[model samples]
Target: MTVQTSFESRSPATGEFLARHRVDSSVAVDAAVRRARVAADWWAGLGFTDRRRRLLRWKHVLVRELDGIAELMHQETGKPVDDARLELVLAVDHLDWAAKHAGQVLGLRRVPSGLLGFNLAASVRYLPFGVVGVIGPWNYPVFTPMGSIGYALAAGNAVVFKPSEFATGVGVRLVETFAEAVHEQPALQAVTGFGDTGAALCRSAVDKIGFTGSTATGKRVMAACAQSLTPVLIEAGGKDAAIVAADADLGAAAEAIAFGAMGNAGQTCVGIERAYVVDAVFDRFIERVAAIADRIRVGAEPQAQLGPITMPAQVSVIRRHIEDAIARGGRAVVGGPESVRPPFVHPVVLVDVPEDSEAITEETFGPVLVVNRVRTLDEAVDRANSSRYGLGSAVFAGRRTATALAHRLHAGMTSVNGVQSFATVPSLPFGGTRESGFGRIHGADGLREFARPQAIARQRFRSPANLLSFARTARDMRVPMLLTRSLHKRG
Candidate 1:
């Protein structure tokens, strides 16, 4: 049976439904992909410069209408308008960078041919994957999904986007703008529905799928994509950690930990869910962070520093983590289960939590963070890498030592002394390995993700091995084969 987008999307701050629509069926998904194929051909045929021009025009729309878009995002998400703009600002910057750099990074390049193929010329080029399916999350809806959509378009692939059911209005607006930028075809289209719509995309004949959601859902998506041997990139959930060393900048650490933990009401996949503070600064650091958390308020009002929890199901997850930690000998240094006030979830600063507690080891996916004291940097690193997730991390230490510690963490990207800044830097690749998901989604790696590598070789002449063809060449084979073995062997 097919599902409908009948569920109401409510504002987290006010608990009011925003908008709703009907879900797309397998039939609709197939039609979308078919349309995308034709669009892909047109999008691909355009020179990189022309494609970039179109993208820039689309970006201009976003810039000119920034205030309107930001307000819509804020009303729909319950996040402050300022915070909503943060998502757009970083997103526009990435769009700009991708447009300017796609040709230089993704154009054809020469491949070296060994001496064995001296008479042949070889080169490699990136070919579009035809159509790509992007299943995006509701948090930072525009910025997150655009990471896949924009890059796929720049790489010459048409995108069929299935945004989170909760953000169908935003998704529709995005597609409307995309159509405006390219009047000839539907380069980007939306299929608004629930998991069934996403599953339909997974089962369809699309060339690749890019998904961003929880780890459990990611596993299911991977299994579904495996049925078609379709490549997938899953920017799944994370239990990202921040390490506060004795030599760290305490003020900066406090700011990073607080925002990394509480931003988007802690709805982000790469948000900081755990913190390891050096025993030396544990007391003072905790006090400073707690003060910051206390000043924060969660409501629909524009003055609040933070907002209410966006996903209703996430409320239960946050409660479970806090209760589990408290039952497992952990204490809530600041806020606890009582902090979750339905529509508006206040920031919870958990301290004295066990390193193995669910609060520390699991993804609360809320405005909650667990702070544990460690004696050494070794202990901090060990605790940070203990979880099954390894998406993103942060290290607050000396420049040299921070880089060293970041390398040791089992994550894809690390911010040396900042929070969420790595995701803003389009120059670096994004995404994770292991349970966090495989593959990348930003930078040159992102452009290549929606494309397949094609290698071409041109032969100038026949090889010496042709001498052994119909003639009496037993002796010739012996000489050539012997020479091949001798040349291959290390003296």
Candidate 2:
């Protein structure tokens, strides 16, 4: 007889295992994809108006059960209830927005046939890609994954979600709510397991995959996806930086950095991992941040300002970051390497860390920040852009700070005077350009990612230059070049 052991999931607030079930070793994720494939036709046939109505009702269910949903997330991840509420609220808004905007964004729109091709009428419409597979992270599980799931569903593609093992309960509850709204249809299905389950989802016959996790895991996921030639959107981890100018509001900057860095025990991918302040105001900014961070407290209760580290494996990563920082002549004014108090790791503030140090070079993914001083904004931008990870960034500058620094930072999303505020606005596209991964997860970009544009051009009448027929001649291409040169030539 063979006995299989299980991986136990525990609550970060309390050292108690929450669930211990045998892992699902099924390699049949293709069936889940097929179910979704069938569901896609039914879902898309709803046309945008009916889809909007259904999704609206779904959003209502989410709003009605917001408290319960938040509690489940809080209990599973050990994040504050308020924080969970924050994420769910955004997700709710996105569902409503996506449902309403899908028709307009994905609807067929006519394209102009240039003067040379006047005989042809052309148009393009975004068509659903059948099925999309989403592998979500534990931190901000709702908001992050919904960016893809909600949009994919709205665009008429069926979604199969694989939530993080640690947050599977939360995923189940969300899916249960959707089932209540949509009846017993597998429009959205949740598969629970460890990395194997996730890899299966990737290897399974899905049109596209959207993954959010660490960089190393992201590469592995990409490799797996490559096996099936599956297109993927990887919202990998980031080492985001916040720059504080000398003329900025020191108090607000400090508080923003503190909350942005320490929120959710710093298990955030876009969290403020580093802070670069001008030498003229570095000392003042450091003082303000240290004071604010020290005042913040972590507790097991739901009302606590901060909570515990959700993933147990991350505890070691956090410790190593702090220890490495301290060992390399970095000073921790507020908290240090021994800050681990069981499930919760208290906030730590480091200063005077070399830009080339391990703490600055690697992603800590904890409630910690590495502060450095630069002589000029040029130096600040250089240091911020030095890292391989450029997922997100923030700048505290004068009136032109956001506009000017926007061009300097190499990341996809950057917020001025706020930390990660770009993510809240539904108009902007989220997801990074570099190691953060490609493909967008919000706004128009989100809608397009799950769609394939089928370009159709019908000839109203036989063109004088028939490019597709044997009668066509190479001379047909000369008209376009001549027109282009005539319109803009110096002569």
Candidate 3:
């Protein structure tokens, strides 16, 4: 008899074994994709109206069991209950929006055929890719992956989700809830395992893959998908920054920066990893941030404001970055390297960090913030844009200054006066540029991302000025040139 293989998922808070999940082999992943393909046809036939209604039902199911799912998220990810609840709330909101807005966003729309093709009618519609494979991260297990899964399903595709091994239970629960919503189709499923499982999903016969994880892992996922000539969308790592202008609201800025940098132990892809403050308010900003950080509790307690570093290995990375920053003329105003206490890392605020140091350059997915002072807002913008990863950023300034500074950053999403709140707004597209990865996963753009656009042009009536037919004469082409010159030449 062949022995069954599996892996253990342990709690990051106590290092206790939580559950055992099968390690999905290449064969298993291929089977899941094949099942999805079979279900995709039935799902697509449901049409926009029916699919929209069914998806709203799915959203209702998600809302009904939100508490239970949040608990699972807390157990698997070691996040506080409140934090898990907040993540679930945002995820449910996205699902509702995706379902409600799918028809208007992806339905066929008439397009102008132009004067040159006046005899033709043109329109375009988005078609689903049949099947989508999603590789989710553990940090924001439900919210992050659902950004792809919810929109893809709304766009008429079956999804096979592969959750991070550390958070397999949460992924399974989400799939089960979806299954309950649309049981006749069974179009949604989960495959749980480690790196090999994710790689297998990428290589499977899915039409596209939506991946959320580290930049290194995203490259690997993209490479695997490339083997099959499959299209992929990646939401990778980030070293996002928060820029505080001299004219910014100090109290509000300090609160936003502290929460943005320390929430979920700073494991968010769009978390405020660095801060650039104008020289005039640098000292005052640090003082306010430190005061705020000192009051935030970090532990596994129910009331704790911050939680453990879900990935065990990240503690060391956080320690290394903090030490490197301190060694290179940086001062720790709040916590320090010693703050990395096993699973729970308290907040750490480092001031005057060098630009070239690892703490400023690398993605330390822990509750650590590095603040630097700049002579001018332009210098701060220049320094923020210097990073290789440009996922998300925050700008706190006067209305005009904030808008101007936001335009200068290279990030995909910039929250003016807030920190990453754009993520909660379902109408805005979210993703990154540069090393942070490509493609979007929210709003109308996200619905279209899981689909392919096909354009149709039909001849409404037979015209003497036919241009696309072999019967067209050279005189027909001359007419267009003459019209172009008359309409556009130096006019």
Taking all chains together, the TM-score of candidate 2 against the true structure is 0.96
lDDT of 2 by residue, 1-491 (tens): 86344566677778677776445554456677788888888988888888788888889999999999898888889889988999999999888888889999999999998887799899999988888999999998899999999999889888999898888888877888888888746889887778988998988888899999988999999999898899999999899999999888989999899988998888888999999999999999999999988988789874587898888777888898888888888999999987877688899999888777778988888899889889998889999999898899999878677579868999989989989898898767899977888889989888888888988888899876666777667797677678779986986
User: Which whole-number lDDT from 0 to 100 does residue 86 have in model 2?
Assistant: 94
User: What does candidate 1 score in Cα RMSD to the true structure?
Assistant: 2.2
Q: Which ten residues in a row have the lowest lDDT in candidate 2?
A: 20-29
- Candidate 3 residue runs with Cα over 4 Å from true position: 1-4
**Cα lDDT tens digits for candidate 1, 7-73:** 6766767767677677788999999999988988998999698899999998988887777778878
Write model 3 residue lDDT over 1-491, tens digit each, in one string.
98457988888887788889998898999999899999999999898888988888988998899899888888889898888989989998999899889989999999999988798899999999999999999999999999999999999999999999889999999998988889897689998788988988888899999999999999999888888899999999999999999999999999999999999889999999999999999999999999999999887778888878898888899999999999999999998988989988999999989999999899999889999999999899999999999999999999999999999999999999999899999999999999999999999999999999999999899766767789889887888889999999984
Best by lDDT: 3
Q: Show model 1 residue runs off by greater than 4 Å.
A: 1-7, 464-491
Instruction: Give me the overall lDDT of model 2.
Output: 0.86
Instruction: Check candidate 3 and list the clashing pairs.
Output: none
Model 2: residue 112 alpha-carbon error in angstroms: 1.5
How many clashes in candidate 3?
A: 0
Look at candidate 1 and tell me the lDDT of residue 338. 96
